[model samples]
Target chain A: MLTIDSLTKRYGRGAPAVDDVSFTCAPGTITGFLGPNGAGKSTTLRMLTGLTPPTSGSATVLGLRYPDLPNPGRVVGVMLDASAQHAGRTGRETLRLAASLVGVPAARADDMLERVGLAGAERRRVRGYSLGMRQRLGIATALLGDPLALVLDEPANGLDPEGIRWMRELLREFAAGGGTVLLSSHLLHEVEATVDRLVVIGAGRVVAQGALADLLAGSGVVVRATEPDRLAAALRAAGVTAAPTGDGALRVDADAETVGRAALAAGAVLTELRAADGGRLEDLFFSLTGAAGSGAPARTEVAA
Target chain B: MTATTVATTGDGTSRALPEVPRIPFSRIVSVELRKSLDTRAGTLLVAAAVLLTLAPVGWQLTHLTDGVPDFDLWVSSARGGVALFLPVIGILAMTSEWTQRTALTTFTLVSRRGRVLAAKLAAAVLVGVAVMAFVLAVAAAALLVASGLEGTTPVWGDVGSVVGGSLVASALNVTMGAAFGAAIAQSAAAITMFLVAPTLWQVVGTALLGDDAQWLDVFQAFARLSSFELAGHDAQVVTSVLAWVGLPLAFGWVRALRRNVS
Candidate 1:
């Protein structure tokens, strides 16, 4: 398991990069640490792996702080940057060094290379590996320790669609074997497709977090009617949160019955109304974290 | 340091965690040694050190005296030919991590930041010592060949001080290189400052301060150390060595331990 408790980091006098963030990842589950760029996902992971010290609070793997563990590499496998491998060494040598560090046999490096589907490219210098190849090599490095927990940052950023699918299955298998996995990403749809749980953060603070199914099950109803503006106005008049999404639709922060009544009062003919699920979660996700745009959830955008 | 514990272990099978032995310091040093030579440039540097040694010995042999050049003379020539190149290897080993942005991977594998630095320094020193041994072996062979050709005995004068002094000198140069590497943390900038700053200071400081410049001229001190003639002015040599090697290492160590690796 991995635990981050009240972690915060400030640079000189600037605002905290990660502000009072707290979360936990249990074994047998994959947690998606979702955020936009500069949302402190990498910083958090860095502090968790003891690469960057937290200004306050603590992040621990298994049962101890990273450095305090007897051998951190053997306890938690961290791949903070896919491109962090040394450019001079071949793919196989990179894993060999890490294997030696963790007190594992050197032969395991070959096993991990084949496991990550980089068997044929093991002899290539990392300088020659493409970004996608590097990501696969990074994953192979992380798994070399045979640790119970894995922490990765932007592991899928450079992968092709097939590579992404391969990574998803790899993570799923790791979790099924009772390992804790924490993977961070900036893309919303990517996380929606891969994670069993979600911790959505914006502006360095978590806005929503729960089991994926539980969070989606309790989300607001999605409604599209003849009068998009009128229905939205009626929902607000009744003190229910609502906002327009990409298409001509209103995501109301209430159940279908309540939304139906509000629409009826507004004298709007409904074309579609139902509980939020799949794709609509994006609208709900945006609403919870406020408007998703070029920057920090610009002004929450709810008609209040 | 608050006490806390999660309800899981590293086995990944819901079983008790197995013992995870800490990586021995020797293993880290060995890995660092391999890392120093694994790169193309690194391999070339060692090869250059070897070739550079040969150039001086060959030059001395071609300009033959009555018999083979004395043992001490050949040691001086070999040491003189390769002093600058030895330190470049040291500087590259220390600076490569930051320049190539591999500190992230390195520190993650062994997070006791200080130990990794210690290992790099240790590996660097070992390389220096090994190179000194190689230089001595080449000098010996040259002396024997010269004596065999000239039909006279090779003079093995002042074997102890002459040979030991050169080994110590090479070690100092490489250590100084590593010191600069740690302080600057970039390959080109560190190499430039390490190779140029002392030479520049010697020219300028001597013109201004004359003999007093000896107190700060690292190259002059290295010359004295390599000649095994520090019978006097030991204080000046100590001061020069401290300014060159000690100051930079201290600064680099503190920064490395505190700086965040992003």
Candidate 2:
């Protein structure tokens, strides 16, 4: 299990890059750290891996602080950025070096190369590899130690469709094998499908966090019917607010059963009547953050 | 598969997980060596060292009369390879981490930032020593063959001084390169500064200070560390060694340990 307590990091004395953030990830589960661009996701990952020190707060992996952990590479596997590679070394040599540093056997390096599907090109220098190939090589390096926990930032940034599927499967398998997986990604749909729990942050502070099911459960409901106006009126009378979703449909804050009963009671002709499942998680994310375009979420200071 | 069958183990017993061992230093060194030696630039540096050593020896053999040249001049010329080439190797080593974005992978594996830096320094020092040794061997062999043809033996003391000076100079150059590489974190800029700055200082110092230039130039201190006399003045080799070699290395170590990898 990984526990992050009141973690805070500030570039200056002003707003922090990561604020008073706290979360935990248990073994045998995939936890997603969700945020938009510049949402402090990268900074938090860096701090967690001990690459960058937090100005305040603390993070512990399996009951040991990062620095105090015995052979950290054996416990926590991290792939912070796929771009972190030397162009001069070959893919095979890259993993070999990591394996040596982490005390893993040289043979394990070849295994990781095959596992990441870079076997044929393992001898090729990293400079010649495409972005996606580099990312795979990065993941292969992370797995070299056969660590108990995995932390990755945007691991799926440049993968193809098939590669993405393989990555998802790999993550699931890693979690199933009793390893904790903490991954950050801007891809909401993928997160919704892959993560068992999620911690969403905006402006450097967590806006919401819980199981995926719970987050979707409280997203209100979307109601669509033939006589939208009548249904809206009925919902208002029933103490439930309804609004047009700008798609010629009304989204109501009532469950499917409640909306169904209301629509029928009001004799409204229904062409479409179903709960909106709260649209997509992406819409909900935007609603919570309220940050558009290049506007970063407000920064909050959290103590580690 | 019933709820009643699921019992909570409240006895507070914990099982220990299997331990993974730490990687050995020999493997670390080998891996670091492989990573560097496989590169084109690494190959180029090695070639440059060999060529630089041979060219001077060839010139002295083909042009000089039938007498052994000053052992000091011969050794000094051979040792000059470190001052000329090791910095490029150092720049490649340090900037390669950043340029290739391998810093993340490196730190992730070692975790302890300080250990990685130490390993890098160790690798660089080993390479520098090895290259200096190779140059010395080549220079000795050349002098032996040349003496066989000329019927004159080379002076041993001059050869010893040249070897000692080259060893120290190579160590200093490698450390300086590592320092510059860490501080700038860019291959092109760091290598350029290593090559350009000293020459620029020498030129500007000569132009501005004339006879008084000796006291003001930092490159003069480095040149003194080389024990290579220029113009008519003798350089304070000891002071040069302390300032150029000692300071840059200390600065690099501190910066590497403290700087954020991201």
Candidate with best lDDT = 1
Q: How would you encode candidate 1's per-residue C-alpha lDDT over B85-125 as one tens digit per residue? A: 87887788788998888899888888888889999998998
Candidate with the greatest DockQ versus the true structure: 1
Error of 1 at A83 (Å): 1.4
TM-score of chain A of each: 0.84, 0.92
- Listed per candidate, the RMSD to the true structure in angstroms reads 4.7, 5.3
- Go through the candidates in order and give each one's C-alpha lDDT: 0.83, 0.75
What is the lDDT for B114 in model 2? Answer: 70
lDDT of 2 by residue, A1-304 (tens): 6888999889876678788889988777898998877788898888888888899999887666776665777778899988778777789877877777787689999999999999999989888998899889988988887887899899888888888888989999988877789999876776777888888877677766778776676556776677788888988888887889898788777777787788889997767766466364567577545673333444322221
Those runs of model 1 whose alpha carbons end farther than 4 Å from true positions after fitting are: A223-252, A256-273, A278-281, A284-304, B1-18, B63-66, B226-229
Candidate 2 on B178-209: residue-level lDDT in tens?
A: 87776677888888877776667668868987
